[model samples]
Target: MSEQLIQLRQELAENPYVTFDSDGNGVSRVLDVEWDFHALNQNKKIIFFGRIAEKYRLDIQSYLYALMQWQKKNSSSGSHAPVNSLIGSKSQLNILATRWGKSEFSLLSSEREWKKCTQTLHGVGNKGTCKNLASVINAMLKAGLVSRYVYKRDYIQWAQPDAGNGQAIAFPEAIHVSILKTVVEFVETYHPYRHQISAAMEKLYTYQDEMFNAKLKELGVSALSHMQMNSLRNRMSRITSQWPERKAIPNFSFHRSGVWLGTLLRMCFICVGLFSAARKEELLSMNKESYDDSLAAVPKVSGVSTKGNKGERICMTWNTAPIAKLALELAFDATQAARRYSLKRLANGYQNGLLTKDKYDAKRQDLESAFVSSDIPYDSEALINKTSLKFHIYRADDGFNMKEFNINATTEDVEEFDLLNPERAGSLKVGGGLPKLSPHDLRRSFVVFMVKNRLGNILTVKYQLKHRNINMSNWYANYSELARTSQLLMDTQLMSEFNEAIETSAVDAWDEIYNVSDTLSGAEGERIAQNKAERLAQGEEIVMSRSELLALVRSGDKSIVLLPTGGYCTNRNCERLCSLMDIVEAPCEHKVITDKAGKRLSRERDNLIASFRAINDMGDYANELILDARKKKIVSIEPTLVKHSIPFDSFNDDIKAIWS
Candidate 1:
């Protein structure tokens, strides 16, 4: 082997694709060419295959590069990007390698070579995979693994893909409200009789094996016999009859009972997803011990953030609504038998030496996951199938009686619902197939709802969604498309609320300017004060009320365009494309300097005076023009400070000494 290959091997050995949880427990490892994110609950393996001429070629450079990237992601501090993203970039490189008929790293010298290899590859026409491909190549170049002759600018100029799937589309407001209402009603109606429902499910679980065998024994049989079904129904009915609120129990059949339990479990998932804005993997990562209601007022749900945390099982907690607490509790109760079965099976597997210590520990950690899918023979595993959850969310309409749920809808909600769904609105039916919903839709909708209702902004949504930055939160909270189609925009009440919120924001800005100083400077500031004084002299109110200020804003008689330099630009139509930070040089007539702006001016004046003193001390005679300009700038700043009653140290004596 070459010396470089040997060195690469050593580096790969030192930095294997392995990661640990927050507590330093081993979570995942890459075995040879396959990475098993076992503890991460990722069922799939990210496999690396490098075959050429019908022989397995161990491309040590590519292998080491992939390992290093994975290490960078799953670092001790925290992950910067997800493992899947790494897998995706690697997969793109793999595709390029396959097409080029050689290792991709060896071919990265020029743009022509990259284009020649990637021209025929799928998705190369778009910037999505192409950008990712370029990123991988750039990383390789920067790491010195590739030729230094390659131009970084060649690949760095790829424009962002215009047609890529951006943030998930938020659900329509009517559908969003209806889904929440249905789930809430389900929780309210059934949460009281949870113990009885658990008992019934437990009884049904015991007979599941017998029922399965009976159906299997009879050829062409799709379901249990009528007599057998009735027997099971009667058994569960006996448990339901003891409920104090008997109305809580829906009309029960053996099959309907199972459907009800399944619906309840799925509803719990929906409730937590909608309220907490957690990702699907995070929600599925939840266990029976996830919900902490110790502080009843501030309940929290603990889950793993799989996106940015590499495959490390770091526990992240989200403060959730009270309804999430009830939903989690119900999900725990409903999955009790499944949890018991998984634990029993895990114990047996370990005792029989079928599972190693590492495997046993990993399985044990996931034993109590809140969502579980078990078979008739009692074999159970964590629920990770996203399609099953989507189907359940689509079928959620069947879980509740629409008539009962709609009774809680307000007149505005009803009108909005009717406008959105005219076909089934008056009948209170959901026959016209429900809109496709997903876990991500719930998260995006949560952001939109919070921002649109004026309950929060991108920062608050960032906290709720656990986004790494405000950019991502802003993407999720983008509701411009939804607003165009929403009935709320047409409703007078909603328009009024929107207007009030805008007016309140404007009023707060005005209050900051007016209340910051007794007197204001700048031409517009002087004009505004004169106008108010004239009104006061005419027997009008001396102090403007919030309502009057709002009217002024509404009438477009005054406007507040805040500048970055602690001032307001009151010019409604000055039409100068001016840089906000260039206020010192290009001062506009519409600028109004408040006390805050005066303080800023004071700092500028102090700095200029200090510069003049430094020039005088340095005996820099050639900088005489510079000294004169600084002095003039200071002279201009002092008047604003004096007018606003802001304190400043006078540098007139120093200026006189310098000139003399």
Candidate 2:
């Protein structure tokens, strides 16, 4: 075996507790190993920094103070008794007098001058902070100005440098403390703080410092070289902020085919989010209760059905359910359409169960946007399945078949599949493969649309959008700006004459469009005046009341509704009918009928009763069919599709197609 491989084998043998797998790639080398002896041995002293820090449940700041006290008590000469050989006075504290210290190091300034400088620095009084003290002491030691020695096993004392060009020397206890401080600070700042941290413990910083120093020693680096050790710790602590977000809905455009597929998956997730609007963590942590599929329609979103929140967690999730439903259904439909059209597109689908995952202890996966391109997992071949028997057969329409679709699982299954074990969910089976979009953005888009449409109150918006902070849901404000401005404009007018002018101006513009003269001659003006008088005598069409219009709307004689009320039907093709009477009296068979109270009645019921009377004259057979169908499982006759065709002349051929 090669030297590197041999060294690795030795390392494995020495540290049998450590595990590594080489697979068929052959033996791998162990690059480095570090151990902390001081951290391991500190308990034999009067107090251990790690133990005190952990036991008291103190933060790093307070732990530093506790460590200083422990050091002071244990450093006295009489207290230097070693209970176990594991720890002796190998580490000790020393205070040197300025005059002797200066003479020993051949200082330009006396020790008194240095002490003055030290006193003025931060963390000089009481137990000085480790970082600050360590920095000062390290500078002094590097300058060859101070020295120290342990006179007894327990306590440290000062000493003069040996009189030679190559002088042997000792370091001050304060210098060691200073080094320890730097080490602790570095560890505390590490990106993922080393798991050793315990808020309950005292002297956390001190313990980390000792551990770091010991680690350096184990690596054959001079732990006594505080400057080098500090630099190394800093390097180890550094980390880059490359991963901007844990979950990313991928950034594919809505126009892309992948986007359609992605959007569908994302839409499903968004519906879940908006419907649940659970806290971010909770949303990610969701289980089965987050959705209800009891009806054929979209599931109702309710937080009462969610988990992870404290207290009753009872809050009504009120948002525009219709738009939410539309966006999701559209996304799903678009995806199904894309996959059905192409085999290559099928290959681009997301992994099955991508959104379904277990919540606990599992790593959160990336949330792709409504679209993403294909890429293999860089670290493993586990995701590849080309050789599997299931992979060779194409299933472009697996999830799209509603007749064969099954919605058997409950909230529990969703939770298990979606939140808990995301990795497992990521591996789910989909006929065409996973769609591009993920679930969370579906919720975000809902919030975006709600705000866009001005569909709900701020509280309702926040709940439906599932934002914890009201401020986070400001995206919708821009969409409602135009409507709000119009409302404000309508509520205020400078003068009644201005309103009349506005009305008059509209008619004048219409008159101008019909080629009516802007300036007519005397005879022409006289003719116009005569026509106006004649029209006034004849009287104009009657204006309907709000109740009358509402009745018409309810009756579905929506077509032929008046010009102004024409906007109500979202379907673009319906005729604009202003009144029920206009529809009923027209040649068209469709009629809007009203009761004596002027409320609308169902056309089906009215027609059914009429049919019954006509049928009684023929026989009891028809009545029996209706009765038996309702009362028992009788063989029912097939119902025919109703067609209502009107003559071409009856329609206002001049009117534009409503859909256009």
Candidate 3:
């Protein structure tokens, strides 16, 4: 490790809070250092040996540097690049400076001094500061940048392995199925109507364009193409992919308002997200034109937003509700309406409020693009259905705002709102005072439902969950509580079956009871398992006599009845292996038949006669042989039918008819 990091580690190990938790008897558990765990200084975070630096993919050096910068100047690393994002970059420089005196990322002099200084970063309530301190210092060591190793052994002892799903940070919850259902209901109840731009809005955009064009004409300013507008907007918006370069567009004041459209589209996104499990970024990236409306039963949605393209139709009869599809339809309409509304608003602005004939003729060239024609009037029907409208559920001002919908509230000044629209926010507030649920949680829950509902086989569930490999599918299956419970239940049931077999017949039973004790909440499964084990241990022959077995067979306790002969082969096309009797030939009384056996015997007799008649048509000689064969077949069926008390009058009549 680098010299700086080695010294930093020495400093961290000396901190009082870095010690492990212990009990009077022994070590109880690792105390604190949890991902969410905090310390005393409200502005700084506590770093410990057990912290997993790589969990958040943080660069330790940058984070430590940022923390030092913040401690010294109350400012971040001043990289003004993505590196500034390591930690504490979003906070006020002055506020950070107020918390800790100026500091530098340098080697420490002594253990006592290091420990005293580290107290500032240790056990701090402000996780951001703690993380910054932890990560940056850790990164220096991780990169082998530490030089001085005065306390290397102590440092090694302090850096313990992480305890569990270590650094347990807050992730979005799996939006409960019940809450999701209510949210859907809310959408349906208060969905906004499609946006409709008034005539005055058209005049506003048109006039604004004219005022700009007139000044440009006086100065000979060339007309800007639509593509150029997009380029200018993008260029002026962000010069760098960092906090420092953020700038607002110079020319733009207000584009247009589509608040209703935003609200409606949010519902659409939610519905699609629940069904398809689209991440916020993926859902927003979807184009209105991308929806595939074809295919029977479940219409397919291609590109349903994944790191890879697994977006085939997962709309199985079980996993999805019909409302999600309806929501998609609504989303499409909302998208179209928003576009129509914005374009018209801009066009109207260019034309001004006044509807004059002279303005249309004079500004014919510039108006030709968005307008219907130079001389033609604005057609509301055509305007809405215009082939060129592009509305991409982006943000409230333009498209959909996923950030707003997902967040509980934006700021204090603005009114907090949701479909639930709870007042004074106590309970029943959507995404508020509740576990935060992300799109991935919805996905995990979806897999759980697949196992719980038994909606699909393993392969089918895998396909629906859109897993790339069977290993991942198996991993998810392991995640299912229902699946785990089912395994326990099946094991218990098998033990019951085995115990019964051992009692009625002689066989060694399987033991292995204690192995599954953890899964068996109720002792019944364990008891059953124990019974079999005890019998096996006793070495007692558990077989019953033939009479007992016969009696047991007649007891109607089992599903498939057993007989001395082969099974009641209800298959009419059988080879007659059971007691050497086939359905076409005869019935075997010893057959372990179904209740439908009586009907089979009756069919056997008629089939015999039919064959006899067909052979008789050939000649008398052939008929004689066929008659003999048929007689034996009829005789075999008559005995079984009579034994079972299945009326044989029909068979008796058929025999007479063939002879007569």
**Top candidate, metric lDDT:** 1
- Candidate 3: what lDDT? 0.39
Candidates 1 and 3, the one with greater lDDT: 1
Which lDDT tens digits does candidate 1 get at residues 522-628? Answer: 77888777876777679874457677878899999878777654567887776654343243455677878777778877786787687788776776557666776
TM-score: model 3 vs. ground truth:
0.35
Ranking by lDDT: 1, 3, 2
How much lDDT does candidate 2 score? 0.30
Q: Which 10 consecutive positions of candidate 3 have the poorest summed lDDT?
A: 35-44
Model 1 is weakest, by summed lDDT over 10 consecutive residues, at: 383-392
Where model 3 places Cα greater than 4 Å from the true spot, the runs are 1-103, 106-177, 183-263, 293-325, 335-441, 456-479, 482-660
Runs in model 2 lying further than 4 Å from the true structure: 1-264, 270-289, 293-299, 302-454, 466-483, 486-660
The best candidate by TM-score is 1
Please provide, for model 2 over 1-660, each residue's C-alpha lDDT reduced to its tens digit, 9 standing for 90 to 100.
334224433544543321122222212121122111211112121222232223222222121222322333556541212222111111111122221122122121345655543343322222222232343234334323333211221111121122112111111112212322332332223212111111101122233345666676677864336676566445433421122211122322222213223323333333344444443333322222333456536456433322212211343443233333433333323232222222222233323432112210011111111112212221122222211101111123442222222233343333322332232343223322222212333344344334434655567766665557777565433233443444345555645556556445433332331233222112223344456556546884323334454454345443222123111112226453533323334322222111210111123323434454455445455365543222221111001001111111111111111122
Backbone clashes, each candidate:
0, 46, 44
C-alpha TM-score for every candidate = 0.58, 0.21, 0.35
